[model samples]
Target: MNRLTTACLLTPALLAAPACALDPQPVNIQGLQFYPSLLLGERYDDNYREAAYAAPSSWITTLEPRLRLVAEDRNSAYRLTYAGAQQTYHDDSSASHLDHRLLLEGILEFTARHRLTLKAGYSRLEETASTAIPGVNDEYSLRTFGATYRFGAETARNNLEFAANHERLRFHDDSLVNAREERDASRLGVTWFHRIGGTRALIETRYEDFDYVQPDSPLNSHNLALLTGAVWEASAKTSGRIRAGYQRKEYDDDGRDGLESPMWEIGLDWEPRSYSRFSLTTRQAYDEGDDGADAIKQTRTRLDWRHEWSERLSSTLFVGAARLRYQGLDREDDLSSAGLTLTYQPRRWLELALGYSHWDNDSTVDRERFQRNLYTLTATGSL
Candidate 1:
């Protein structure tokens, strides 16, 4: 839906929807619980357009209203959600837009050992000026469907999971008609887990196929990855997973170079105190390139710390760095970013947050380089 439709549906809901049920609780409708919420935010962006020179600043306002319906029984759980975010720029109307998403998911456990999970989602999203030609906003829609099945329960000695997913991407802007950006991608993967005391030793195999609708889709390719990982779930103070693997991506056009790279991912969380936590994550992976390259290899790492100062106040700090190596192109980029946020909840159903973030990007292509800072104030209300 567009901004008008979203606004029309959101106005009355924000004012009266929560009053439908009287007990300060979710309303019961058709055997499911209904939850409604709204978020309002105001932001000041120093570089809203992501310009490399003569950057302009703007004040932005965002409104989002969401509703969720959920049902759960002994054997199964199901949920449905819809959300729309509309953004308006005080100085740049051309940069304003509305984004909408819908999602549905269900989990079914027939027995203690067999479980099936399914999900599907659709998003009408916009690619802001950063990904476009500096002045254009690229619009696209995505539809995704996926399912996963597990063969063993938590206490079992071994577990097996089978997963499959498909995605369809379509561009809406006429400026992208010849860009050949529309495509379909499918992935199939399986993992085998062997329990080793408090940890699990695992191996995974994945295959992916990409298809483009444009004639002579030179970027069409098949990819494969073999990975081995270890999982140590929540324990006394620490939990995390590490995986190392190799991936090979071959393209349909022999003239264009392919990518064969080593990949690894690490994630860990430590709770040193009852009111504090620290998290670290790192990843090296490949993403399909739309910037005149076959693919891009990205490496990044981040660290975050969260502490609760009081029963109703909390703060978080984070820093990150990344590098991008574009395959089939001589361009490279280094990126650094940091952010801090403070949140307070004076009441159970209301929350407020203030945040500030900064980004610095250095690219071999001059047009892609920029530095930006943003400040925001946000509030959320729910019933």
Candidate 2:
């Protein structure tokens, strides 16, 4: 049998074996709890750089270890997690690298109905050259902090939330990408929600500011948005949210024109059967671009379905499409992707997964069109 066919058949056979020993449980030190996990995986990518022509394929082996710590009381909770990964490439040794991520989150209840949520995270990772400028592997560090406060009784019909977030992105090798692309962004928003029958009506307004490290950058801008939406729980089997709004961006440079676009987001989750679930999501927004453009207006839609095949086996299928239009240029790209993943968890702390994905891009610019495929097999164990 071919490699693909043999792999497909072997996965199910291994999962169908008798149950194995249970993994070690979490460890508790005083009031803090810790859970540790390790993941080993192999992935084959037909187009590692996502080049339009003459794509180079590679085989990658990954080793990841993660630890999570949590502490909770009657009115307060705290969590900290750290994950690191080392990846090795068979043919492309220069592309191998180590990645690290750290996240801290907390929730505090000051009063009976007043609560605050906070989160901070830092990550250092590398991305393929196609996703960035200069056509080389790019390494970057990202830091983010956010906080939200909610007021009103939990049983009340009305509530209000105020939130603020900040993020900074820095590149390690500035020669591969422009230092002007490094930026700091801040966002402040407020939301009010009122319960009406089984639905919650919400109105929100947000302000965002983007500042580039380079003074001569033309991409620095401020954005304002006003939105109204509703969240409905029609039944136990269906829940969803829909929001529509208008956004306006003002740029710092007079040579480039700003943009005003209609913004919207929608999401739905439906479970028609006990063992099956469906999800639908769509969004329209403006994203930062590293191609010396002001921004990229993007609209994307996705649909996902998950079903349980047996007690220890489940499968998920997803398809998505996106359209990206460069604000200050006549460039547009249409992209689509589809993927399927099968997972098996015969033991509480051991899991295996197999996945395949296909991606296609059609751009107005000829050099941006490409098709790619990926196959992955992973096994994870936790203690």
Candidate 3:
């Protein structure tokens, strides 16, 4: 199955610890720093489709290439990033696919106190069709643009931030079985921060609107959220952010029911020693759904521990669990996942990692139950 990824991807259970990798030197070209990198990997998945019965195994080859250009002056900074992934299957050629993404981001320090951030991105994504059509793939395009303005300086005691974002999605309907799907989303938000010593207290409010292309679709809704949070660096060994609030979703049509939930996201990190670190992250939110399901309430929690065995070798272990509650359908799912990775950095320009992962899903519907085990070996390098 095709997956969404950037240069550094954080899987459901596993987190990336880039601090362990030695930085590769970037070349300068026309005042811009250029970085080019490539990754090659081999994977064996026993249940690639997550099917409960008649599971198929496959050996997959994966390739990814990335390019980044960055330029920064005393007043402004700009960046352009591109990445692509190609996956080919040895047993199921039909599952092989390629994905691409491009992003442009910039920051303008219009007088330090009145700064602005801008970003735009485009992605061509392919995902495996739902269980009903397990053999096919659905292709789609996503376009996004966002901006943020901050009205405070480094020494300011109080700060205010305003942000806005817009996104559009379109599905490719090149085949007879493919039906076009499209959606547009827009959001506006504001935040206030009060600085107190090494910690910052914050309050934010946001409003979002979703519109579906289908006439009078029940999926159209308006969302509102108010959150209160804090960001803190307690000491040299501890730092993190925690946010909690309430969210409500109201449908455009009165016939369909709405939803309200308590939302929270918390991430904490601790380093008892310089060579070992631990992280805990958790989140609760609502997501759109398909297949006769109107919406899904999801809660997830994960923990990661990374320990360095030596100057050049390290290991990381991650475990996570999730609960999915389906709205407008009498179905619920519990998920458990774990992963272990051993990384070796033998040279300044090369890194190798061997990893294994297990994922299990138990659902109220027997057809949705499955367990998967995957083994992978990956090598990354730069010239």
Q: What is the lDDT of residue 230 in candidate 3?
A: 92
lDDT by candidate, in order shown: 0.81, 0.81, 0.80
Clashing pairs in 2: none
- Ten-residue stretch with the least lDDT total in model 3: 7-16
Candidate 3 per-residue lDDT, tens place, 204-318, comes to 9989888877777778998899999998899989999998999999999998778999999899999999999999999887765544566778899999999999988999999
TM-score per candidate, chains pooled: 0.92, 0.92, 0.92
* Pairs with steric clashes in candidate 1: none
Task: Give model 2's TM-score versus the native structure.
Answer: 0.92
Clash number by candidate, in order: 0, 0, 0
Which digits, one per residue and each the tens of the lDDT, describe model 2 over residues 1-383? Answer: 01111111211111122223225476999978777888899999998788898887899999998777878888888888778999887878877889898888888999978989888878887766365553466777888888999998766799999999888888787553446578888999999999998898999999999898977777789999999999999998999999899998988887767888999989999999989999999989777765545678889899999999888999999999999897666788899999999999878889899999999999898887889999999988886
Q: Give the runs in model 1 whose Cα sits over 4 Å from its true position.
A: 1-24
For candidate 2, the C-alpha RMSD (Å) to the true structure equals 7.3
